[model samples]
Target chain A: MTSQDLFAEISIQAEDFSLADEVALLEKDNLTDGAVVTFTGRVRNNNNGNSVTSLTLEHYPGMTEKSLAKIINQAKEQWQIGRVKVIHRIGELHIGEQIVFVGVTSKHRQDAFAANEFIMDYLKVKAPFWKKEQITEAGKTSENWLDAKTGDTDKAELWS
Target chain B: MIKIVFFAALREQLDCAELSLSADDVKTVNEVKQRLSDRNSQWRQTFSNASLLSAVNHDMVAGDHLVKSGDEVAFFPPVTGG
Candidate 1:
């Protein structure tokens, strides 16, 4: 099958996210035993002991969606996935704001959990998003942001 | 001419996303990269980065792969998508 059929529930946005709606949509398919697992990643106000006030995320426009689509297709190939939803936010964001969400529905909890973890691991290492953290300090001002975590690469490698 | 594109951190660091190089004697992605590397030291550093990825005609490919004029060659860091 082509990539469009597999990416029925993929979104990359700049607005705030709704986790409940995402989970509900992921569980919409039939022949499911009602097992759904989700993982939500939020933006924290600190990075490497620095107090971050906000984060500015940048990404490659056309390439970002293409890469995410491939990652979702890979997940579908590995497991008996019913429905999957992935939402990633770009642009400026504050602390505690939702950054990403992954919802997986399957016949059993094992598959759901596995899919959730798989999506997250792959996203961390494969997504085209980059973050720049703006730090607020008492006396000095410094902005710091790093590349996607190397630990994430290790995690994704384990699945391969 | 060959159209080469850059993305993400590579784009940010290089200050431009698209470049046109003379396709004469350029037959592969490696040849295109080498032509670019000869232009400036920055291009060399970007290409020398081992983690970078290459794409030809919108499909990811190895550097040694053959290419032709008007081919779209893109280079970027390893994908980090979920």
Candidate 2:
């Protein structure tokens, strides 16, 4: 395996992640990187005028990791990147909790920024994780499966 | 037998997690889906959803993809995680 491949990591877990710790680890042993970029997605309290109390994420066990790895590998091929880390939290997550993270390190700001965004966009549309939000409307709480946004699909297709 | 699995909302709607069905006559993913939906009205409703997504052995594919005796097929709604 190439040394660059060793710097990449992907985590799919039920526990929350520390952004600072993740970034530090991504930056570890970096000698040529001049830029690092990271993105985090959080659980919001509301969606489409409903009060979202929490989100429960479910995924196809083996497929989720394979799909995520495919996205990261795509990014690696598209950019001259050094390090990549992707962490996505599953199970129940409350409002204001972090849900996903994508971090990339590269020698140039353009590569780092573009690769990070590229990974996030593709991950949104391609990953096998499904989020079910507990939304309250008129004092009735119901679990609603979020529909894929056309805008998100468009954004991901932009990379193609 | 071919193993079939459901995830997320589709699993809840179908009231099934996983099941094994004889693969004797089913040759494609679409055929398996057609047989599953024939179980009852609830199963029919969920599988007939136009937006349902599916995978064969962890790789996403269309309804016409062929299946084998031991192949695992999964069905679900569109992915929403970022």
Candidate 3:
């Protein structure tokens, strides 16, 4: 990997990302990388049994990227990760649409897997992102912002 | 002056995203919440919610975190993302 690949790249956009392309970018020309792990989160048609029509992801402008970088940096400190790339989608999204992507490259499978999971676990609560679910039932449409689950906080705390 | 911002559901409930405050009026995150709560019943109810979270200069902090002029403070509900 080159010096440019030494740091993590974080993108907050409204456009969807290709998982193959993102993973390829992380592994491209990285001869030392022995393992790569990628995780994609997609919007589901139903959340908690409600028929979710769509999801609108909201994030704090400057702080969103900052928090992601912080999570990536934390992962680097704990594992021997090579390249990390995180892309999170915002704005409106329909059911089954992609919401977030996290890819990590490392010299071994354990490191890559652990780092990938770590970034995602922290992103759940540490990053300033929120999800609002649009539900339609019997032709009546309503929306509610999803609250952070206590389980997410517990998972993040376990990392420490 | 200090900058304060709200995000997500908190923004919708408070009907605000950002505001400016004189640093002299508040010295900590808790003080800012108290001042905001004094604005009206709606604000009081919103800020007083136990689940509300806050940050100073983009890092999560507790209510007692000290703040000063030029600081950026944010308030929001717990984040829900993956």
Measured over the true interface residues after superposition, the C-alpha RMSD of each candidate is 3.1, 0.8, 0.8
TM-score of each: 0.85, 0.95, 0.97
For this target, which candidate reaches the highest lDDT against the unseen true structure? 3
Higher-TM-score candidate of 1 and 2: 2
Model 2's alpha-carbon lDDT is 0.90
lDDT of 1 by residue, B1-82 (tens): 8888887678878898898887788988888888878879987887788878787765668889998888878887765333
Model 3 over residues B1-82: C-alpha lDDT tens digits?
9999999899989889899989997988999999989999999988879989998998899989999999999999989977
Per-residue lDDT over A1-160 for candidate 3, one digit per residue giving the tens place of the 0 to 100 score: 4643565899999998998788779877888888889999999999888999999999988888889988999999899999999999999999889999999988899999999999999999899999999999999999999967889989989999
In candidate 2, position A151 carries an lDDT of 94
Model 1 bad stretches (over 4 Å): A1-7, A29-33, B57-60, B78-82
TM-score for the B chain of model 1:
0.92
The Cα error of candidate 3 at residue A144, in Å, is 0.6
Model 1: which docking level applies?
Answer: acceptable
Q: Could you arrange the candidates by TM-score from highest to lowest? A: 3, 2, 1
**Model 2 lDDT per residue over B1-82, tens place:** 9999998888888788999989998999999999998999988887889988889999999999999999999988888997
User: Model 2's A-chain: what TM-score?
Assistant: 0.95
* lDDT digits (tens) for residues A48-90 of candidate 2: 8889999999888889889988888899889999898999999
